[model samples]
Target: MPEPVVVDAMGGDHGPAETVGGAVLARREHGVPVVLVGRAGEIRAELARHGAVDEIDVVHAEEAVPMGERGTGGAASGASSLRVGCELLRQGAGSALVSAGSTGAVVSCAIRGVGRAPAVLRPALAIALPAVTGGATVLIDAGATSDPTPEMVAQFALLGASYARLVLGAADPSVGLLSIGAEPGKGNRLTRRVAELLPLLPLRFHGNVEGHDVLAGAVDVIVTDGFTGNVVLKNVEGAVRAVLTLVARSGTAAPEALREVARRYGPETHGGAVLLGLSGTVVVAHGSSRAATVARACAVAHDLAGGGVAARLRDHLTAEPVN
Candidate 1:
């Protein structure tokens, strides 16, 4: 039997009600079992409201982490829902963890509680975006480590490639370094140094890729430092939302083609980003996630856990030294 996914039921914008409702939906629609970790009384109340009290289990967590507390020293303390959820994963109570909590808290607790995979210097947050040609393109280091070494960028390429194969089902995933220009020496010192290191790794190196190539799916995976990646991701998301809003306000009803395009570009439909390089599968959902987004996040966690993503990553990383 597959292990259950541990959900931080009290950690999203909507709290327990929406989180529990999403867990129920995941079980009903995707057949994925989840154990909700939060104040037992509140979680049970929400489950009872949906008449799904018997469908899932609830674990007690005394506190909840506030969104503002992230990135601070206290983010992972306080017996918070995310902290307890990570503890459960460490103890084998669950195979993976899905949280819409503070990304810093989740990342911190995961590293401290579950530890990092062997040979992995840092974990990366990977977001999959819709590709123009057909499949999806993965952007790594979305917001995990803001300042990364050139070697870390090289590791991100490997981690992203493994993800593309296991999750995106790409055969021989091609990797591209996000830079100012497509030329080998166009980026800053980091990109130039990483460019020289990428070909030496066990991946299909496609040289440098400009910003436009991201949506064009010029490569299966685009690797960059966390700061730049986060800025690019937010910009793309904001642009997509603005365009969709304009289409809605236009006199004509949104056509099916336009709606499909919106759906394809939206982040809510894709659940959220996954934190790679950890010993366990950890999914970080959007902070403003509602029930549908939570359900998709749960499904993503279950699928990645069942696919043994952590194990694959460990093997791939250990196979060759990063230095």
Candidate 2:
């Protein structure tokens, strides 16, 4: 059997109960083994509540890092659950890692724990969204950096393209620059410069794609600075919730029917932004994630492990010549 996926069971907004429940669900429903890292006793209690205490193993992490807290490098010093989780992967004790904690902490810990591929200066977060064009599209640097350079954006394109092909099975992914307008000269300096660099990348660079193109799935991969990516992601999420609410209040459609529509809208799609360029799979889900979301995140982790995403990305990055 393969190694289990490591989960920071005490790090999310809902704490060990939801996190542990999700791990149990992933193990039972998905046939994926998960190692819950956190306070062993609390984890056992939560597992016992779901009557799945025996189904999963607990790796004790005496310290728990709460969501929204600053990293140790800055204002405070606290034990990061993300660090412990990533260490498990580095030690070969886990296949992949999943945590619905602080995104900053997760990225920092993963970079420190597993280290980045030599070619990547900073790891990025990429997410795949179900698009209107039947298939899915990927957006990168979703809250990983407030500012990213053209070089970083170029690297994100490569990573996103590789992931699109490897995980999503897109034969040849179309890379696009996420900008304000579809016109070549419409975006800011960073985007325009990045667009200029696109021609040098290995993938097919389809020039400047607009906001609508993201939902329309006009391109396979969309690269942007983290600030813009985060805004887009949050806005889309809010829009989805608003639509669901409107549908709920309209009474024209039954709750079941509305939910079914949402389901088809790909709401059940879970898993957080995946940190690219790490030597192992590390997923950072939202802090407020529920049990089902956590379970889905674990499933995503399983997918990455099965797909050999880490090794493939490492090979792709390392293949480039040093400057």
lDDT for each residue of candidate 2 in 49-168, tens digit (9 for 90 to 100): 998877888888778776765555621234455667777887778888898877777776776677554466566788887787677888887767668778878888887887788657
Q: In model 1, what is the error at residue 158, expressed in angstroms?
A: 2.3
Identify the leading candidate in terms of TM-score: 1
Worst 10 residues of 1 by lDDT: 314-323
Cα RMSDs of all predictions?
4.0, 4.6
Q: Which stretches of candidate 2 lie over 4 Å from their true place?
A: 48-55, 68-76, 90-92, 102-105, 108-114, 130-135, 165-171, 180-189, 235-271, 286-292, 314-323
Clashes of 1: 0
For candidate 2, what is the TM-score? 0.74
Query: Against the hidden reference, what TM-scores do the models get?
Result: 0.80, 0.74
Clashes of 2: 0
Model 1, range 1-323, lDDT digits (tens) per residue? Answer: 88899999987788997899899998898889899999999999999999998889999998888876664566577787888888887777888899888676777778777766557778788988888888889999887878999888888998888788877889899999999998898999999999998998889999999988888988999999999998888788778878877877895765776778776666544446789866568998887888888888888888877776545555544434222
The C-alpha local distance difference test score for the whole of candidate 1 amounts to: 0.82
Global lDDT of each candidate: 0.82, 0.77
The TM-score, computed over Cα atoms with residue i paired to residue i, of candidate 1 is: 0.80
